[model samples]
Target chain A: MRAAMKDGARGASMTPRGIAAPVLGGWSAASEGVPANVRTISLQAVKIRMRSVGNIQKITKAMKMVAASRLKGAQTKCEKSRAMVNPFVRLLGDTPGAETEQTLVVPVSSDKGLCGGINTAVVKYSQVLNAMTPGVTYNVIGDKARAQLTRMMPQQINNVIVDTTKQPLTFATASAIADQVVARNAPKTHIVYNRFASAISFKPSVATLMSNEELEKAAEEGVNEFDSYEIEGPDRSEFLLDLSEFKAGVMMYNAMLENNTSELGSRMQSMENSSKNASEMLAKLTLLYNRTRQAAITTELIEIISGASSLESKE
Target chain B: MSRAMMRLARRVVGKNASVPVRGASTQSRASIETFMKNFEQHKTSPTMEHPATSSTFASTPVTEDVKGTPEKMKLNFYLPHDAPFDKTEVDMVLVPATTGDFGVLPGHVPTVSQLRPGVVSVHVSDKDVQRYFVSGGFCFVHADSTTDICAVEAVPVEQLDPEAVKKGLAEHQAKFANAKDDVEKAHAQIGIDCCNAMVSAIEGK
Candidate 1:
């Protein structure tokens, strides 16, 4: 998927130039870096390549518009999900870190590509965490991140969840994931993902969630403001267990939703940039094609004039 | 889209299509309706019958610039995908605490209660009340008179369909009875509670 997406992104920007010189590589080197021996190419070949490049430009432009529209809907969904902050985080801000040595890392990205470096950033962050924390086992989500992480740390992966890109993230899917992670009994869980900051930017962040036992330990210690609040319900311990588990699910859902929106935004941004680059490349190609054609016509005209003059003088 | 809106959208489209296809077929529609009524009666078995049970959201950050006065309570109600109220001032907010039904009024003490599946009615004014039926979640009534109710699933009580509630309860009960594991049993219990609460809300029990 990554290779295919890279192929699509470089797109007409390279294929046309490749036609100009069948063996030349470093797609941007001859085309953009140096004003390329494009002038030496035959006029007919340049014209054919120009048409193909123009078509690519049109395709990229259309994709950009479609992504823009989809981004709007996705943005709203992400914004609403932002409201689902882990309630436990608010009430238990003073809760201590994990007592157990085990660490679970959940890297959230998507299966698809062409969304820029969001997935790579998340995967890289997970790798960094692995370096920092020993005894780390991964519960990676999204195929793109999972594949890369498995390649990087095959032995450490505890779970590999894919197909998250097929549809939107709902509470049901998120909670199921949460349940699996909790069942692993990792006292410390770090959810790594790109936090959607805007249409063009994302912040790589990791949210740390404590296991139910860890949370209960904190509450027992009475460090959190929650300890001070008057509880009126069923034996408080039962509620605490339920709350701890539910909050974990909510956190997982929120992180996935953020990643989902970030993907949309990143895809839109990259597409927009690609369309711009394609158009820029097209403009340069058109100019080169026209200049070469005009030069060819001029050379033909001069040869005819000189030959005719020489023939008259000889006569 | 909210559940009600999604249902309405689907129904509207269906009705529109039927109107164009079977132009002016009122007699046929009437007959089908009568058939549905009979089918519902036969489907509602006595043995499986269960009693009904009964239920904030975000406000506009009223306390963002200044502290909230003790006279008004700020309610922040959030569903996973929607925020029905954000920092909205209300007189009282009724929550179905797992401990029991509890009402938090302005100047109420700080409390955090695990919510049971029941009705939560918010009174914006003495005469105006908005009710919602929420699935099990949590409620945080802070010392600052700022309350946040984070529910897994919340639908306006008025928008719920009784037929769907009945269907859901039956499935919940079946799952509960058949569950071989503790986790599955607990999950089914949540479903049963949610459905039963919806039934109660609809029946005005």
Candidate 2:
């Protein structure tokens, strides 16, 4: 992914000549510093590599902190909003599943990488769902999912929305996505997302948002419960259709929130691990540096002693 | 005069934050009608004051146990950007539903109402009424006396300027008259409708 990102940036910028000069300048400076003995050069390379890794560790640590804070807010928001849909979820539960052959899959993932397995899980789940359903179309959100799914299930992907995981996912974003899904006119809509299980664990889960006909079928199955509330004015069919559309958008919003929380949680965990690895690598490199410096000093002393003995023999 | 109108028309197109789609406008129309009917159903009931205690929210499964009538309705209002109101209990809430205006009390029936661009008047008490301008969303009234209103964007009513609303209305009207295509005309129409509603809300109509 990093390689792809670098390539993408290079293509977009198209300023390789400007970037190459500074890079070559640094390389020349490094070469000028040493006589370039094989062992010394290897040691210098390790030091430079260690410094870069240390810098990366610092960046990951900061990213982890940011993700951790955002996860707290996203988790709470997702939980509260999920509560708001409880009654509707129950009402739909009684509704019979739609008999539609075609299904629309909404895979929720974030744009940023260094988050381990967040996008992969969503893509893998869609693959499973695609296999289960005969004809499946995908409406993918976020760049990460777009990249992965385009490779995994190229034929199924219909639309790809990038950069939706921008800071603060809002209701308008979800509504726009819902509009796109509605436009597709698929009878069964399934949202594949990562459910935030805990700070350390998350599992990809699927929620099915039923079509208008399916809701009516469910309402009929649970008539006693449905009749308890007085529906005011709109025709039953129209009301059901509108309700399904609205709830589907809200459901998508909730799924995005949950997926965001999981993404952050996974990012924080992965970053923490990477930072630890970096420090460990730094320690090992430092030890090698000490050992190599000592060996160089001892070799110089031996050469000096041998030169003095040859001089005494000549005298 | 036509030149001035044209200038205003250009400004209006730029000023309109979100261009409403044909489907949303039609859907809100249906919801407004239903909302009006709901308002009529509850109009005869006298307003009652209840003790105000805000509610906390969780994603727990809905309990099947029969719930006793509560004194006030618990509201959990969420906006996509940030929550304007979250799990706050209130005595009554008058929402501008897509169909019509209606109020929710502690024991209102379980129904779903889509929203249009209008004010959500939340009655926290007899004297404390908090109003918010909601840019289209949904209100779900649960059997457990919980009412949740979710929207794309919401701002406090006090924050809205009547002068701006008037200007917007004029500009949108000019655009509507001069629009060349059906799509452009429809966009201007949504702008007009929203601005008109904003004026009415600010005037306490």
Candidate 3:
């Protein structure tokens, strides 16, 4: 892939030479090793290359700034919301699981590219999940993951939610997605997303969202998990179901925020590295250009001195 | 009342900070452990007053079995998207449960009520009763008399304009009348029912 990309760039630079060579006899001169024009052409190409790389560095720097700011917002949100669901997290851990015939996999990814391996890691995790659990259907959020997953398991691609990352994450977004997942009425839903471990690290993890019937079935299995505290209210079963739905929304929203934070962090890290690489490449290119130009000048001077000496010898 | 709610929020935040997976402060964990111990002690004794806070520990002389001292319950009303009442204190709360419309008071039996789309009248103070139109959710009455209501969506009763409800009811009725299939009719009917409920809630009927 790298070689192909290099060739593509080389081909783009060669186009002007290819089109203008015959009219100007520039190709013939270059073939005969006329160092002046050759040096000029190479110098022009290197300068253009350096300028383009500098532009790319600027872009990556800007992206890093944007991602850094967005990551702060997402991190704050994740921190604020994590507390509300702590009890549920502990309860779900203690609860027994009942397997269903169908499983809905919600892959949380973002649409943007240049975020190194964020989408790829999620898609790969989903593939592993699909391999482990056959007959799993996919409800993809981001376009990048959807495209990859579609390629990997076309039959399982059930729905693809369009990109909404242009706007900040909101609970309404989560509810809209919850509505879709509920509409599908899948008993078992697994939200596969990148857990923001830190600014430098992320781990792809899965959280299960159970349907009302499944929760009822689990409740009937009677683990009696809420033994520590007494719960009072009528229609406990329906309340549990509603609580499950509400938790699902909260879970989805949390996942979205975490994934967004991870994406931003990844983008910021990758862009910082890329901008450094671009500048390094530019520095090397500039050094090479200067060396080649100096070499060309020396060759021209030697040619002139040798020509003068040969004329004096003939005299 | 708000102070108790703040303590609950502090506990939540403290717990979040103490989670080891995030590499948080172990100091916070010790504090949380103390809070949990206090919580467990309260749970085991089931007292009418909180021991830690002595300000509200005044003895209420109860003379009858049916009518106890009117104590207050911490009402934490949360929506999936936002918390309208983050562990606020209220004297009593009336909810329209699917089983039936019921009122919850201090020392009410531990129960979980599935709420319907209707008004939730919260008696915040002796003079102030805040009403909200809650779109279906759940209400949990804890053994310790702390009430938590999780609603899907809710708007303050005063925020629901009568003109908007009337317009929504008309549109839903038209959709219900013009529906070609049972599913569409059922969908429109739900809209109509919600709008009617909104109107009733706004009217304070």
Candidate 4:
């Protein structure tokens, strides 16, 4: 019943569009036959296009302002939360994970669109990583990434966590996602995200989160970074377990925040470019409008002069 | 003969000036031992000059001029929205750990401990100290004499309103009584606990 009601409402609202459809169709159809009538209708068309473009420019400019303000708040949150992850980074310094049979790629992104390929960058990077590595599965947060990854690699996706940006992103939200990654129990987990470089720039980056078992294996493989970090507690094994869990959570939180900040930054920059392009289009259209109006006036003057001369000649 | 005995005693506590126990129980430092001894003696004495100064001794850090003990710890207190204590240098910081309140001086051993809801006092000097009521986070004392407290939320002790805490505590109890589900009960219980902790923290002053 509700669906029918919605359809009825939409059908009721479609009258204006239905009425407009044939007039536009007829105008385009007539334009093809009567080439000489271009100048007369084009002025009205140019004016309409200019008005629409002007409205678009206004909307983009407003979006840019909103994004700029949100970017400031996001940057501060990103900076404040950076403190907890410093020690973790020092422990697990930005190194790619050891090659394992099974790996999990968790792509972090924001849900909203018009963010200048931040999500695309993450999806592309994850795809490349998945291709290069063997036995890789995907667990994605944010609907933006889920939709794109689902489209490209439907079989590879293991889990889809959506609405990550619906509320203010927090440690709890990140940890919930991180818990899903942990539950998969993949030997190697690589989190693909857009690292916030600056207000105008962001780079697609991968942060590796390892479980305690992987850490132990990595230690046997090479350098044991855990020994360097002095953990002064009784239960070393238990501490390692909790530390790794918290470690993954902290890393996830930081990565999610960085991705969020990058999304905002990308949105602002994209909107800025869009606003600029709109203004440029408006400038070009205005110039064309003026030139066409001048041409029409000049043609009218020439016709009047020629008619008067023919009259005088006849007289 | 005396240095060997000192070595034996030091081995019993910890290695290399690092106290295995909390800061309060470290009796190796003569300065700290004397500071506590004098306080005990003054508590029993009739002619105590300043009672207020002596009363708040547990929270306040008494810094003595010990050579090579720079005691200059940098505190980086972080909230999700702000970092008011970014690399702020202080003589000492008292972290409210899950175990208990422990003071972190310079050259302290590296340890990561979970924090409880309590006051973290950063002592700049004997006179100037800043206190924050941290709402449960992790406290990290690195080997580089930098202590970072990443609280879920923190506010200055002065900013907490006692009247609001009282009202909140009563409301939380009522909610706990009325809560039908386990999650709601747990939620109300958390609110009650936090408010109760705040009440004790305010009254403990």
DockQ winner among the candidates? Answer: 1
Q: Highest TM-score, which number?
A: 1
Deviating ranges (above 4 Å) for candidate 1: A1-41, A94-100, A234-237, B1-69, B170-190
Better of 1 and 3 by DockQ: 1
lDDT of 2 by residue, B100-171 (tens): 889999877787777888999999999999999887777777778888787767888889988888999999
lDDT value for candidate 3? Answer: 0.67
Per-residue C-alpha lDDT of model 1 across residues B8-104, encoded as one tens digit per residue: 7667545433422121122223422342233224432222111100001112221223355578788889887888888799999999998899999
Task: Give TM-scores of chain A for all candidates.
Answer: 0.84, 0.83, 0.85, 0.82
Q: Global lDDT for candidate 1?
A: 0.71
The order of the candidates by DockQ, greatest first, is 1, 3, 4, 2
Please list the residue runs of candidate 3 whose C-alpha ends up more than 4 Å from where it truly belongs after superposition. A1-36, A65-102, A128-137, A151-176, A183-186, A197-203, A224-247, A294-315, B1-74, B87-91, B121-130
User: 1 or 3: which has the higher lDDT?
Assistant: 1
Give the range of the ten consecutive residues with the poorest summed lDDT in model 2 chain A.
A90-99
Better of 2 and 3 by lDDT: 2
Retained native contacts per candidate, as fractions?
0.30, 0.09, 0.11, 0.13
At residue A96, what lDDT does model 2 achieve? Answer: 16
lDDT of 3 by residue, A1-315 (tens): 334334434533443334334423543577687765564775666667667767666776888898888888788776555434433443432221234688788889998777888888777666655654546899999988988988878988888997768887688888788788777888878787887868888766656677777666655654333333333344546556666777788778877887888888898898788767767766776676687578668978998999999999999
**DockQ of every model listed?**
0.12, 0.06, 0.07, 0.07
Give the Å error, residue B155, model 4.
2.4
Candidate 2 lDDT tens digits, A3-32: 633433333343324433443454456557
Model 3 lDDT per residue over B1-205, tens place: 5988778766755653433322112222233344334433333222211111100111121112444534777777766445667657789999998767899898887566677799999999989988889977767666566667877688888888899889999999999999999999999998998998998887765
All-Cα superposition RMSD per candidate:
19.5, 17.4, 12.9, 18.9
Q: Which has the higher lDDT value, candidate number 3 or candidate number 4?
A: 4
**Per-model TM-score versus the true fold:** 0.77, 0.72, 0.68, 0.71
The alpha-carbon deviation from the true structure for residue B177 of candidate 4, after best TM-score superposition, in angstroms, is 6.5
